[model samples]
Every structure is written in structure tokens, then in C-alpha cells.
Target: MKSFDVAIIGSGPAGASAAFELSKSGISTVIIEKETLPRYKTCGGGFVFRGRKNMPFDIASVVEKEFHSIDTYFSKKHPHLTTTRDQPIITMVMRDAFDNLIVEKAKENGVTLLQNHKVENITFGDTQILHTTEGDIEAKFIIAADGALSPIAKIAGWKETRTIIPALEYEIEVPKADFERLSQNVRFDIDAIPYGYGWCFPKKNHLSVGVGVFTKTNKKINLKEHYATYLQTLGITEILSEAAHGFVIPVTPRTDIFVQKNVFLTGDAAGLADPLVAEGISNAILSGVQAAQAIIESNLDSEKAAALYTAKLEETILPEIRIGAKLSYHFYHQSTFRNIVLKKYGQFVAEAMTDLFMGERTYPADYKASVTRKIKEAIF
Candidate 1:
């Protein structure tokens, strides 16, 4: 068996981030990916500024477009609201290029990457043994960044407690006229779907349009039909072949545990997507870096590493997600609540969100107390 200090499953943002951080620390690490390098990934491809600011290196080479403002609407005909920032609030990139860039950076930092190698089974003993289609390997520690339906997490018995939500995306090649009109700004229509939202993100030559839903809700809605309606609303009549893809987004962290012995679950595997925006890239990178940090801090001690990771999650990511979950529950569940907030304080709320995404402010830390107070005042 080929042995290494750390082995990461998946080569997405979370896995690549962990590999980069581990390689920088001189740890022997390898990434095993199920797909070939630069393979297509289904996502809106909107990289929020907060995530960009947290990246260790510049991503200008991969950024397709940067937007300074966002246009939000309750519906197609509703009076839209705009939020602006002096700096770009969001940078868009195709996931194939963006993910590959991160992985290449990790390789530059001396991390080994095994592409098109699917891990079939994993055994836990003194060290974790990963049996892959290519071969077998042993690792002192495992970081599962394999995403929403992480097989590694399931084998390690960590996935059952997580909350997974359904999401669908389309890479639409609209007419130049439609593209120009739609690409004027990043758009989000909240009332396009119940318990979720629809977004139009402009890339270099195309638009990434999609709708997602929080499956935990009891509402039965056809997401595909809704996506079609969304495109029609944007006046996009043609969609390229193989442009539609469906995936799941993890909305809440695993409540039971984030770490099990030598295995650490990061990113969507750990259910780290933001509840409010359904954004996962930022939290994925953060958790990946934190996981690497925990291992480094513990000197490869499994128990200590797991404990440290859990503590770091509590200190940083979990609190915000918890508050976000509460906020989403209230905002999506009650139309009356939404109306009250939008009618009375929509502009302030939109500006606060823009500031949060721009890294100038943080949720729960900067607005939780005030938001709670305002909501109470509005309701009462």
C-alpha cells in the first residue's frame, strides 16, 4: 500500500484548499479525484467577494467577470432593488477552470493529485485504508471533501445526520442581445421559487441560470418546470445541449460530529453551505483550511485533531450557519414576515447583505442582534 501523511477525497474547492494548505506546511498529501482534471462541475459559479478575499493567492487568471452590484427582485414584475459596493461584490468563473486552478496551485505546492481515481471502499483501523479503482493507499489522516453525497463520509458513518437540499443549474448560451441585456448585472429573484430562489450569473460568454429549493420544506414544487419558467422570464428561448444539471446543496452542518477519529468532513460533506444564499464555496474553503490547520496543530494526533477541528468550527462557521438557519426559516416560511421586512427595511437589509458578502461585515457578528431586534419590532 502506498502510504501518505494525509489523503483527500475529491478535488473540488474544499479538497483543493485542504491540499494547498497541507502542502504549504510541508505535509505529505495526495488528492484522489473521481473525474479528470478540468472536468465540468454544476454550480452557479458566482464566487462571493468574502470567499475571494479568503483565498491565499490571486484568482484573477480564473475570474471571468466581476460585478460591483446585485439586482434583487421579489418577482419578475416587482420593483427591483439594487445594492452596490465600491469593490466587486462577486466574481464569476466556470467551475472547471476555477477548480482546476486551485488544484494546480496545490500541485505547485508539492501536493500529489491522482485524477480519475474513484475510491470504492475505506477501512478504519490504526490508520485509514482507502481502496480505490486505481489501487490501495493508507493515510494517517483523511479529509473528506467529496461533496454533498460524499461516499467517504458515508463509509465513515458521518453523512446520515446532515441536511441536503436540491439544486439545479443551467449554463445557457443566450443570444448576444439577451446576454448583453441579462449580463448588465447579477440578478436574484427570491419569489421565483418557494423556500428558495433563482439567480442569473454572467460568465465570460454565457449565463449561469438556476433555481434551488430547501427540500426540508413540505412544499411540493417542480424545480425543472420552475427553471424553465425562470429562463422564459429572462427571455432566453434557447438552451445549449447538455446544459442542464441537477445537484444537491448541503444547508446545515452535521449536528452530531464533524470529525470521527482520523477522518475530517469538510465542505458540503459536512453540510457547510450558507443557509441564506445557499453558497458553499466560501464555507468549503474555510472549512478545508481549518481542517488542515487542525491536523497541523495536533501534530497528526487523530483524537486531538478531531477535537480541535470541532472547536474551530464552533468558533467560526457553525454560529453563523445557526443564525442563518433561523433567519431562513422565518423569511421563507412566512410570506407576511417577508412582506413586512421588504416593505419596511428592504434597502437596509440589502445593503447589509452586500457588505457581508464583500467581507466588510459578517453575519450574526454584525447584524444578528440588530436583526433580531428589528424583526421583533416589526412583528409586534
Candidate 2:
């Protein structure tokens, strides 16, 4: 059995970020990953500027494409609108490369990364013991950054409270002409599905085209049909590959509990994905850092660390998630109200969203007041 100060499960953005922070603080940290390094991860691969701003190191080498503006389409009938920023709005990178980069940085900071080790069972007692496929590990603290369907979280008896949504993505290699044209801009069609959106994000060599749906609503939407329609609308006639990747995304944060004794849940394992846009990487990294910070600040006191983590989440992440959930409910479920607001204040909303992505602003800080004002104005 190996003993460590912290045992982090999963080596995605969340795990790697936590390991990086812990190791940098001179904590004995070990990352247990189920897969080999640089394995392909299913994602749209669009990293928003908000995430980019928080990273401690530069990712310029891994960035495949950088977009200065986004083209948003409300529907096929309505003309698409463009939002521009002086700096790049989003940077596209393959998850394999991006995740590998972060893990390597953690390694540089003396983090022990054990690849191909899957956590099989976790036993709690005087000290937490993680039984993995390779062997067993003893750690003072456990950070479950495993993912949306986190086995560690389940083993800890944490009931899931977030909504899980289904998503599909295709990495299509188009012709040189089409690739060049599409690579110049990032596009999102909000009306591609009933309660979802379609995106075309260009990589250095391929385009990541995908469709996602918020399944909490009663709307019945065929994701496959919508994906095909989206490709057709984009004039992507030829797909070099036929294989499509499917995955589940957590769209809401878990409200029940994030910390239990010595065990702390971060990233998708904690259901920290944004309800409005379904983005997880930013919150993943944020939660990872906060988890490590809690342990460091509490001097490895598990009970105190757990309390601090919950307080931090309540002060920062949960508030934004709550507001986002409210906005998502209105924006997706109430279609008539959404259309009216967009039709009248489309530009203002677009700019505000762009600012939010850029970290220049946040979601309704006073959600109730803001919503009340909007409702009154709408009715008037």
C-alpha cells in the first residue's frame, strides 16, 4: 500500500489541476487514472476565454485554432448575428493534448501520476483507503474528480441531484477549401434543436460538429436528425470519418453535498457543469483548485477542509450555477418568452453573454432583482 497526503482520481482537467495545485504547494499527491495518457476524450474542444484566463501556464502550443468572434444563429430563417472581441473569444484544442499538457505540468511539480489505474473500491475508516486495479492507496484526503458518472461519489453514498444530458460529437475531416473557410470562424446555431444547440468548432485538421440537448424538459428531440440537419446547413457534405462519439454531460450542479468528511468531490464528479451552456472545463478547474486550496488552508484537517470547501462553493460556484439554472429554465423551456426577448434585445444579450464568457462579467449577480426587472419590462 502506498501512502499519500492526497489521492486524486481521474486525470482530466479537474484531477490534473488539483494535482498541480497540491504538488506545487509541496503536498504529497498521487493521481490515479483509469486510462493511458493522452487518450482521446469526447468533447466539443472549445475552451472559452474565461477558462483560459484562469490557467496558471500558457497553452499556446496546444491551441489548434483561436477565434476572435462567434457567429450565432437563432434559426435558419433568421439571419445569424456576429459578436466580436478584441482578443480571442475561444481557443480550440484536442482534449488529449490539452489534458496531457496539464498532467505533465503537474508531474513537473512532483505529482505522482499512475496511469492505467482504475479505482475499484473505496473503504472509509480511520484513514481513507482507495482500492484500485493496480493496488491499494492510503491518503489523508480524497478528491473525486472522476467525471459525471463518478464511481467514487457513488461509493461514498452521495446521491446525484444534477440533470445529466446526452451529447453527440463528430470529428469530420472536410476538404481543404471547406476546412479553410470554416477554420476562420466558430459558429453556433441555437435553433438547431428544441432545447439545445449545434456547434461547428474547427480544429487544425478537422471540424468538431455536435449537438446537445437539455433532457430535463419534456421536449422530444431526435439528436441524430438535428445533427444531420446542422451539417447540411453548414454545407458539410463529405465526412472523412463515419464514426460518431456519444457522451453524457452534467448540465447542473449537485445541490445536496460536495464534501463528506475527508472526501471532496470536484469537477464533473460534483456536477459543476454550467446549466446554460453545458461547459465543464472551467468549473472543473475552478473546483479542483478550490479543493486543493481548502486542504492547504485547513492544514490537512479533513473536517475543516470539507467545511471550507462547501463555504467556498456556496460563495462562488453555486451562486452562478443557481442563476444559470434559472436562466436556462426560462431560455429553453419558455420558448415564446425567449424569442420575444431575443428578437427585441438580441444584440444586448449577445454582448452580455460574450462578456460573461470573457470573464469580464458574471451571471445575474442579483438574480431575483434582475429577473423581476426583466419580467416587468417584458410585461410593460
Backbone-clash count (model 2): 0
Worst 10 residues of 2 by lDDT: 367-376
TM-score of 1: 0.95
- Candidate 1: segments with Cα more than 4 A from true spot: 76-78, 238-242, 365-380
lDDT of 1 by residue, 1-380 (tens): 78899999999999999999999889999999999999998888888998998899999999999999899988533478999888889999888999999999999989999988899998898988999999999998999999989999889876487667887888878777888999989999886878888999998998888999863686777999999888877788866543888998888888898888588999999999988888889999999999999999999888889999999999988998988877777677776767776767888888988987887776765455676677787888
lDDT of 2 by residue, 68-109 (tens): 999888875556778999988989999999999999999998
Best by TM-score: 2
- Supply candidate 1's per-residue lDDT for 148: 89
Give the per-residue Cα lDDT of candidate 1 at 52.
94
Clashes of 1: 0
